[model samples]
Target chain A: MSCIPQTDLTKNRIEEISSSLAEPAWLSKERRLAWEKYIATDVPDPKADEWRTINLNSLDLSKLKTTKLNPNLGSFETALPDGGKLPKEMSAALKQYKEIAGFIWQTEKGTQHVYLDPDLQKKGVILLPLSLAVNSHAGLAEKYLTKTRKFSHDNKFSLLTEALFNSGIFVYIPKSVEIEKPFLLGFDFVGNTCEEAVFSRLLLIAERNSKANIVNVLLSSNAKNINASPSLSLVSQLNELYVEAGAKLSYAELQDFGQHVFYNSRLNNYVHKDAHVDNLSVAIGAAQSKVDVATYLQEQGANSEVLGVVFGTANECFSYNTIQEHNAPDTQSDINFRVALKDQSKSMYQGIIRVDKKAQKTEAFQSNKNLLLSNGAKADSIPKLEILADDVKCSHGATVGPVDPEQLFYLMSRGLSQKEAEEFVVLGFFNKVLAQFPVPHTLEWLQGIIGETLCTQFQSQAELKAEAAVLVK
Target chain B: MTKTILTIKDLHVSVEDKEILKGVNLTINAGEIHALMGRNGSGKSTLSYTLMGHPRYKVTKGQILFHGKDLLVMPADERARLGMYLAFQYPVAIPGVSVSNFLRAAVKAKRGQDVPIKEFRAELKDNMTKLGIANEFLSRYVNDGFSGGEKKRLEILQMALLKPEMAVLDETDSGLDIDALKTVAEGINSLASSDNAVLLITHYQRLLNYITPQFVHVMHNGEVIKSGDSKLAHELEAKGYDWITQELVAQA
Candidate 1:
């Protein structure tokens, strides 16, 4: 056990966390192995190609202490229909949170609550806390938990999450069952203090011939002045999705946290034969965020479509790495991720489509488009393909450019202000992919988030000009 | 006598530092339909764009006045809100912004308040039906993927919706077929009234046959070289631009 100062991430503390959760012997052993891997693997090398743009040294892992569980941890009060007593900022965010999520499971301030729709429960769907699911669905959990069998975790962050996660949810859809309404799961790491780290996980299993839709929203609540502190809060999450043969799953995720938060999340989906998966993700908030999304087509006749939208303003930094891997014959994958950058913000996208030797007749497509709205704004887009099969069809493309001046002048000629003109053009640029979401309301919600970001960006400039005009007056 | 709606005094406009409109002058009063006809490079489009306050067309040597207010100093959108409209020769496509939303926003900006939704929808439907435009266009992105005739009709539709005090139609009739030209001409004719005026910039006299202009002007070398009744458009269409240029050279 290596001693690490300023953080409770030592071996003893990790093992104690496992014991405190009252996990089964197998799970405890699993955590111990993950801890061993965490200690063995060093922090990511900044010079590595994937980590070149990101400043890994700035994140002081030692200062990010593990969250202390409060004995009086109560249910998620703000999630109720009639809002219970919560802080002003939390309650305000929850009002919007309630509208998108039908079934809510939120972990905040070291407390976790699980809510399942009664109609869904009657239909034999199971949504439970991860702790309870270990005993109730022991066979299922044991088989699939930490099931990144072929893709080993060479990164220290994944190992750290596996070793330290204490709060999570398990969602299971039975065979041939279809839920009309999508499920919503929220993981919030909130704190008033300066130093805290929250680790959470999600494991979703869709059985054969079943269909499900889920929306996961990751958020954080922190004091406005917390940015002044050298170390504020760290939110780390991992989600694994398993879609069986002849099944379909639509998953959408949104990462919206405060400026005082650094969010790290990974989403991995495995699709079997004749199954379909649609994944959409939107990243708009956070001081710094790194997200990895991977979809593996594990059998013949599988298809996966992934779409992502990211908007960055001010000094926010976001990176998205995606992979579409075809392991079997007759698989198809398509991916498109668009980013709009304004102010002095920066963004980068790395996408890969891999087809193995045996994966003949495979078709894959990927693209990343970026719009830089300001001179100081920067963006990097890289699209790669690894094709071992001569009979496969694969293509990738990327583009980085400023907003079209002609388009802006066109809108301005129609009596729209410059800001409104830019917002309209940007929204149109993203709608090519946003309109593809399976859930209709999700498109509207994503548009609202993009709209708010643009409004803040241009409104501040307008206010500054107005103040200057007043001073001259 | 009617009041002058717009007056340009020796307007010299340049794009990329190359002078496109040099010392051009024109005037239009309320209740008048005037057509400015010229050859391809005769500065007709440049004059319209400069009058509409397009930033690319720098008014280096002259002034444009709308209702006695200097229009050159105003931005493009400010010119639009001040009852000046330009039907572009090439309408710009704003993808993902619905036609209905665009019109509503334009109406709001012109009126300085949001038009009630019900009222706006009713107005859009009424105007669309009148112009032979289907209701489906209201849901589509503005000018995106529309055919030549469709873009022209949409321009006229916007002019009708905005009801500007003065409109500069820049080659709105160039790419339209005979049937579409008549339909668009009727749309323009419907919008024309005693309270507003129209300045038509076109290379052909086909549109003038549908909507008769009370006055016609010939443009050469970025200036209006001749002004007469509608017969001047007919004379130009009959003899082509060479006949006029030959006469000008002979006289010089």
Candidate 2:
């Protein structure tokens, strides 16, 4: 395979990366283009309020290495607590991130494979691996390949991703094809492998009047070297989930990785006239994570909603930024993020709602609330609104505090312990956001997923024993 | 007597350091209904809150015995589990939590298990209907948007489900229109049984028109200065509270 780069802008390193698997000219060129874009983007600066809390300079990219997976990988399937199925809200595995369309990618050996739904391809949907997409579907892929992930646009890691981009999926939804289930994207970082670098990209473009739910999940299927570096997973995702006139798009991004893992995500969305875009995400499993989601309302009556539920535990650090841009008349945008932080964890939420002059009668609200479980835990919230339209209604609110003790006392006075009381109150806050919209079985599943962590805090063996009895029942 | 369910002796209570119930003494056996009537600041509500073990109501001195067990020694929830319930004049509103949901948690906390969902729902429906509360009320947050009458009815509904042996209804009839007042009275009347004791605290004599009490105690200046049967409510209503003030001052 001639996939290795010819130049030294992180090029020579490409052959060793590709020659390790053998040369493929088309694959090398795709990686080369991605590297160029990554190098082109600027390093995120502290001056940018959105990236202030994010420690971009602290990343050790020299550790991100990619190698082959073990020969015999075991199944990573296990029943979720209660043996109940996961929330079935998302559309099925996406064919939109396949190798058919011009897009390049990165993946570790023996794990973290991207599976595209074959049926979607038959519907004229192009789901291609990004690297392969460059040779086969270059036109569409080139437009957004490095717009967000390239170095010139961002920094060295962004450049590093462009230079050593490995695994990803590119999806193009043809006009008017509605996918029933979410297009599911799963990245399984294999355990104890020589793989260091993880540079991945996923492009999603939906045409007018089409609809689908996309769920992107990151998981460390194996603990493979817990110390592995370039252990960095720089995922530059450009989702032009353009909900054309009357179209709809629902997306969920869930990140869960091993300790000390560095994960960064960039999500972009554009909603057209009378279209709807919903981005629901949960960030729980990383040593450090930074997520930036931006939504643009391009035409009249377009709507965008971003709902996030995050829990930061132990020494974890989470940074979340959301931008709601109202470009047209009568557009609506709302971002509600509820987060809970425990132990010494830290959380930062910065949300901006901007309404342009043409966006008269625009309605936008941005709010973030945090529940600090421990005295050492800290949360920073900065919610702002920029309005250029006099007739628009834009408001932003941010609050960071521990759960109200009075509420806890109320629940406890009803027989819950101090810990159970806090859990109830924290979950109750998120329950407000949950009740605002129609979600799948997300509440029940996430409850089971999150309850275990909270259950350990019971001071009274009585409460724990009571919970146990219920569990047994 | 039918196993004294509640016994309060020299119960001294205070709020923000101001003594409210000064050395009060009271006793309620199982299967008894007693009314504590007094003017606005006569410590009737304070007595109810103190019994419920509200943290703010400082019990400067006193021992509250319930079912022959030490009441003040236990926490509020433990005290509740021991069969004591209080229907607040102003029920707390918890936003985002449904009325039925709050009831369900209270039920589980009282029962210590997940009651079969269907049975719980059916019981809630029956109780709400019995209290004349609309079914839509169950879906709203607990007392969040409830009118005065609805909050009172919901309190009785909870009292019905919780089935506490000794209940302290603190002016349950306050702020209610006649129709809403009737709804609450009817709910309390339904809970009237030989196994439980009801302490209906009030200032007006109208609520007595609906649910007749076995006895009425006229509380004044942190102490019940006068006691009588159901007829006392009528006598006080006819002469107004000033008559009691005259009698109290004369006694002093």
Write model 1 residue lDDT over A391-423, tens digit each, in one string. 988888999999888788777776878878888
lDDT of 1 by residue, B3-84 (tens): 9999989889889999988898888899999999998899998888788777788888987899999988898888888999
lDDT of 1: 0.80
**Model 2, span A271-320: residue lDDT tens:** 88898888877777777777777888889989988998888776778888
What is the two-chain DockQ of model 1? 0.73
**Clashing residue pairs, backbone N/CA/C < 3 A, model 1:** none
Residue B143, model 1: Cα distance from true site in angstroms: 2.1
**What DockQ do the predictions score, one after another?**
0.73, 0.47
What DockQ results for candidate 2? Answer: 0.47
TM-score of each: 0.94, 0.83
What's the lDDT for residue A182 in model 2? 53
For model 1 the local lDDT of residue B6 reads 91
Could you tell me the TM-score of candidate 2? 0.83
